[model samples]
Target: MDTTQLKHLLGEMTRAEKIGQMVQLAGEFYKEEDSENTGPMHEMNMTPKKMTVSGSVLGISGAETLINIQKEHLAKSRLGIPLLFMADVVHGYRTIFPVPLAMASTWQPELVEESANVSATEAAVSGLHVTFAPMVDLVRDARWGRVMESTGEDPYLNQLYARAFVRGYQGQDLKNDPFSVAACVKHFAGYGAPVAGREYNTVELSERTLKEMYLPAYQAGISEGSKLVMTAFNSLEGVPATANKPLMRETLRKELGFEGVLISDWASVGELIPHGIAKDLKQAGELAIQAGVDIEMMTGGYLNYLNELIDEGKVSEELLNEAVWRILTLKNELGLFENPYRGANSELENNLVFSKEHREKARIVAEESIVLLKNEKQVLPLTHHQKVALIVPEDQSKDVLGPWSWKGEPSESVSVYEGLLNHISKEAIVVKTIDHSKNDRPKDWLDDVSTADVIVAALGESSYMSGEGASRSNIKLPAEQIQVIKELRTLNKPIVLILFNGRPLDLTDVVQDVDSILEAWFPGTEAGTAIGNILYGTKNPSGKLTMSFPRAVGQVPLYYNQDNTGRPLTAYNQEDKYLSRYLDVDNRPLFPFGYGLSYTQFSYSPMKVTLSKSEREQTDKIIVETTITNSGKVTGSEVVQLYIRDKVGQVVRPIKELKRFKKILLEPGEVATILFELNQQDLEYVHQDLSVSVESGEFDLMIGSNSEEVETTTVYLELKKNE
Candidate 1:
């Protein structure tokens, strides 16, 4: 449908029909039994007629179910407008991949893009129109359960991932592509910085901080042509984002150039009442429509009260028409009018869902996402001849497919014990599947542990421990699991801790008990196969920490790019009382961001910096080059990171900020000169007044394996005078 057709559809819609287009409901509400005024329908005061015109249905997939529902809905519709189906296809639909946090650790946007394309392919065939994914919220606090959904804390990396995800999900032609699904970048404004890392908590940040730190990723998604944007549950500066007009309209829509449909997060529009901004659902609907929230998900705030508000002149008819128009435009763009079933086909779904080709891609992605945190005296790459004890909770392996994998079956996931059997003989490996929660440790378990030359202890938080409302105050291994590790340490055997988790955990105690630690963060369906390959030298671990692993839970919001305080503790003033030092612990993370170990080592030579001109203009580029050599005797991959520190700024700057990074694969004794180019935009920072600026001053250009361990060189930037 063209613009003229969409306008005609909008004009043909009645006041109530237009209001219905701004409402979204779950799959259960579309059932034949729901036609009667009872259950959720009665609760939301929705009539049979109103249900026929709902703009979208979420949490519904599978080609057969959606076809039946859409057939039923269009049959009852006066205008024959099809219902849009959306779901939270965060990581995958059926062929599960690692969580977004794990994907970010790979630092390979192209690979991430491929994973997303696979997800879109599966989801499109499964009857999904939009996927609320590429959750580009920049998360610093690992205590926030939703950190597993975001790319990481860095804006530059998040921006790269956001664009990649949008490109992959929407493809080159979203409207014409059957394999692609419209991507919805979520929680638009400061959703990740919830106070105390608690879910749905208030977010208090300066406008400058919000734009500088959180908004870039969402902006990147929009710039890459994501079709939809979802609002955050948290309030920014006492205004809930669903009802925050300046944020949704001014910053997101106008400044960021997001002309796409803006939908509220699940029940967020109705949440404005609890947020103290609305007296009732009517007021909530008024504020949301005013704030430019086109669709209210899982709530009847728009359907129940939008018409009344419009009748009372509290909400404009123009706003209602615009929202409905956008919804119609999206349906048209999806080619729903021509073929309401889009790409949904049960036959295609069966062939594509968790197919061998898709699972292979998942295994490859999961392999790159496993970070080797510690390898003392080269304890890893276990020999097949040696006896190995695989210590794990009986049911923990099934939880490898983490949260938001609505369609993935845990039973299909490969277990760690099974993964080991792929490489090592079953007779040589003893699997002690003990319940970690049990108080009594069997004598047989201890005897099995004593017999092994090396203990591969598989442990960490379960799928339920992290992701959406699973925030924890103590971000560490459970006490029972810690005690089990402590007891195993007495065996005097080399211990390899294979951690399965969603976020960066405080590993202060575990570091002492284990000789090697492999951070295998919920590696989806092929979890065991990927870890097995890495453990047996078939594959090298190249993943790095996207978020810092705090040494203690007290450093809840620890990140690499933190601003240096006025009283920052320096090496010379280490013992100073007034400095910014922790009284009980060191002010360093267990492992810094971009910190990961490989089976082989790489060394970097002194960096060389060259300016395009001696007195560089803002348009001229600055080139930095460094030679990285595979110093060890085995092939490996390394992520060479480039960071910049501005000596002076209008506002205080972070100690260092990651600007560019490249992942290079090198053979034994191979040397490669890595080069990076930067301009004034790379050096720009958000000021207190919310204006971005790049000052003329010296910047410390640092290159290294990680954020903390870097070699530095100084360069000056002199901007040309304005005419």
Candidate 2:
């Protein structure tokens, strides 16, 4: 539908009907009989008329079920407007892929895009219109459970993944693409950096810091044409994001150029009352509408008080119309008027959901996302002749599918024991799986460990340990698992620790107890298969850490690109007490960002930086070149990272910032020349006044395999004279 048609439809809608379009309810409201007046309807005082005209439904999907619901909803609609179906399809729908953090660790945005495309295809076929996914929050704290949803700590990498997710979900032409679902980039404007790494905690960041670090990925998502933006649940500067007019209207809509529908995260609009900013639910609705929140999800704040606010002149009719207009326009853009059932077909859902082809893609993604953290004396790639003992401290067969997998069946996931059997002969490998909560070790556990030539410990947090409202003060392996590892260390056999987790952990104690450590973060449906492939050398581990692994829990919010302190700790001042160094623990992380291991080794030549012109414009590019050689005896892939350090700036600059990176496959003894081009925008920083500008100065251009290890060369940026 065009603007003229949308305007005509908007004019025809009554005040109640228009307001209804701006409210979203859960699937249960529509699925159950409304005449009963029970459950959510009774709690929210919602009327049957309100349910009939609601613009959108979330937390439900199924081709047949949605088809029935849509038919009933259209029957009651005065204008026959279709209901939009949205769900939290964060990682995958039916065929679960690796969590977003694991996906980002691949350092391959193209693969991430493919994974998201598969998710969109499966979701659309199941009758979902929007997926609240590609959460581009910049996470530096592992204690925050939602870190599993974000890309990583770096703004540049997050930006790449954000665009990839948007493109994958919406496809090239959303209006004509029935197999694609509209992407909703979520938790806009600093939702990741909560205080104490706690869920829904307050975020206090300076405007400059927020713009420089937290806002880029969101801007990247909007620039890539994501159809919807969900507000964060946390408050910024004491104002809840759902009710912050300056943030939603000025920063997001005006500055970020996001003209799409802005929806509240779950019941964040109603949460404004608890936030102490709004006196009651009525004021919460008033403030939310005033802040330009187009849709209130799972809340009666908008439905119960929006009309009253308009009647009392607290909220304008123009605001209500604009909000409803955006929602209607989105529905039109999705081609819902022409086909309310978008891609709903039971036959297609059965044929496409968790298809063999989709599972293969999931396996490939999971394979690439498995990071090899430690390999002492190359104890991995176990020989088939040697007997192996697969000891799992907990029953992790179902736990392989991490959090937010509402539709995924845990029974379908592949366990490490199952994966080992695929590679090693069943007779050569013994398996001992026990529940840690039972406090009962298998009677044959020690006997199995003593006879095995090698031990593989599959352990980590459960699916319930991470992702949203599951934050932990101690981000480490449980005591029982650690004790089991320590006990296994007495066997004097080589131990390989395979971690299935959602976030980077404090591995101070476990690193010493294991000969090899593979960080296999919830490898989705093909978990066991991917681990088996990596373990047996069918696939070399190439995934890098997007988030740093801290040595201790005190370093909760650790990252590579940190600014220098006035009194820095250095080799020259190692003994000084005045320096900014911890007395008990080292300041550096146990493993830095871009840190990973491959079966083969990669050596980098000295970096070379050349300017296109000595004095160049802001848009001119600077070329950086380096050569990487696979110095080891096997074929492998390497993530070559390029970083930059500004000598001086308007504001203090980080010690190192990741500007560009590439994952390249190299044969044994083969060498590849890597090239990266940087521009003035890469050096730009948000000043104290919140204005982005690049200063002309010297920058250290560094290229390496990871953040901590680099070969550096100096380059000067001489800007052209301008008014």
Candidate 3:
């Protein structure tokens, strides 16, 4: 019956019709000429730009323009197979939500899911049919440029975010939906663990690490019903992930039971020539298709060479038919095949630039994603009555939104100053720092910083500095921005540093010097207001930092859950004796995992586990309860983290692994109970042979503000081997 609907529809398609399903050329790439435009991807493809791509990727998103382009492709193509429009609607579409990294910091699946839901509703209404999102890559090293785009360091959290994103994007029904664009969980296998955190770099990992840590998120995405997957540009075991049949076919499709399509990352199929695996474009096409890459994204790998590769017996016709069927089935599911341009609802388009509700929601997400990283001497939750000098040290126009905020507009975007102005009375002086783009810049925003009661200095990477291709070796603030902060400190006024960046930065100098610091990681269009709300007490800042900030770039790639070595430094004062310690600096990082500061202080009592191992043989339920109290004058939210330490193991394990975390908001002088009900499923980990099972052990339950600082309790559990 399923085949009947798709095959009968396919029977009517001509050669061009079928070919269109396989092609995915960049739709809105910049072109030199209008009449004969090939787009940016053509140069990478080594072909003329005028090629008729089957699917057009609107990497450049403008609702009206995207509709026009898709229409043109449908009209121009010989068989008239309507083009599927795709884009990197990564976080927020138009109304920017927090960056994916910042969202992960919340450790709240509900927020992440709702944010994705809003993204899908907005993007679909804006005329997009598919999104390359939820980029479910598990990143450990913060120095890697793309770290800002992933859920940090843990497979469990990444899985939670993946499932949330998939449900938000596709919803419960895929066979009939116009507003929800089909979710495409991307960079299929091990894209996050690039060597030295470089982009599109080689991945090297043991089979156990790969199975236990790296592969779970992809499995989660598949289980959540993600319809499409994109393979990574990097190679695993020296074979490109895009061309690794074992990973694509064996691990993903067959083992994980994913029946969806596997698309290639941008221009990656043709890149096999440089990878030295394929002789030419034709060979590249043969290898990728045979390896299970169903669609050639912007590379023409399947477009010009697939048929010939099939004729030569390098790729089976069965592969082509399977690929085509997967695509056509999705199209049918989207209701696109029956009504070619089903998503092109003019009413939705007409009313979809942005609305009051969208802006309001953006504000909420922005506020929710702002992580209070450090605040010494209890210096935050600024009052409206206080005369604050909001210094736009970096270009306010540029830094307020932080990089990769595609939806944010300068005037329309909420400015930190605007937020301040709205919260305060007429008496409050909201001074604007001069826009000085001089050849010789000043030390700070202005000389007289001492006069103000408080100061707000905005700093970090400009918008567009830390997403896909934005890799940075030295993760430090620009010299100019650093200078601004240093100069403001001369006045001895309590200063608050607002950092806007995609990835974590090494701010050892600023952290020690500034009174307070806010990590507002790319807070979208409503950034100013969200930040402003937190500063003037409209909203209590509840976000926790997802990635760890390093003291120096030398301590790069630092994360929690790293394996303890045999030579872990035990000597009180010794030189490098092959201990897991750095010689130049301390092995410890400036900040640790699960670290964040609040305006108010939080006290945690020792943890209590209600359920025991004796009753575990039945329905296993571990009810963990911890009391979190606000012991400060101001109100703030705290994220209580629970970590588990395997006291003894057949194999080596990390010092501490995050079991669960709860984000709770508390008023001043208030106490709340935090609880997590974990099942036996939660206790499972890959054995030496690489299958998940819970083994009996004496486990240490460590509760902490961050990974390094912990108050722990011990618990004994009994389970048979292969448990």
Q: Count the backbone clashes (under 3 Å) in each candidate.
A: 0, 0, 6
lDDT of each: 0.90, 0.90, 0.76
Q: Per-candidate TM vs. native?
A: 0.98, 0.98, 0.92
Clash count (model 2, backbone only): 0
Candidate 1 residue-wise lDDT, 416-468, digit = tens: 98999998788888888768658878665788678889999999999999999
User: Tens digits of per-residue lDDT for model 2 on 1-723?
Assistant: 888988999999999899889889888887656553788878778888777888999998999999999999999999999999999998889899999999999999999999999999999999999999879999999999999988899999999999999999999999899889999998977999999999999998989889999999999999999999999999998899999999999999999999899999988988998899988899999999999999999888888989999889999999998899889989999999999999998999999999999999999999999999999989988878889988886556668989988788889988887888987788988777757777657665698679989999899989889899989899999888888898899899999999988999999988998999999998898899999999999999999999999999998799999999899888787888988888989999999999999999999887777787643344277899999999999899999999999989878999999999999999999999999998777888887887777777899988898999888888778854233
Instruction: Estimate, for each residue in 1-723, the C-alpha lDDT of model 3 and write its tens digit.
Output: 266967876777654456557777665443435233244554444333334546545465556666676666666665555667778888777767778888887778887888887777777777778888878888877767788888788777889999999998887775566668888988878899898878888999888998888888988988999989999999999999888999899989888898987889887898898999988888888888888887888776677777667667777767777888888777777877666665556677557546677778777878888888777776777775688777774456445554555555656677677777777764565454534465355555365456678888877787656877777887888766776677777778898988888888888767867988898887877887888888876777777666667777887777778777777775564665677777777677776667777666889888888764444454356788889899988777788888888777768777788888877778888999888777667777777987677767677778877787888888776664552
Q: What is the full ranking by TM-score, best candidate first?
A: 1, 2, 3
lDDT of the structure predicted as candidate 1: 0.90
Q: What is the lDDT of residue 589 in candidate 3?
A: 71
| Candidate 2 lDDT score at position 314 | 90
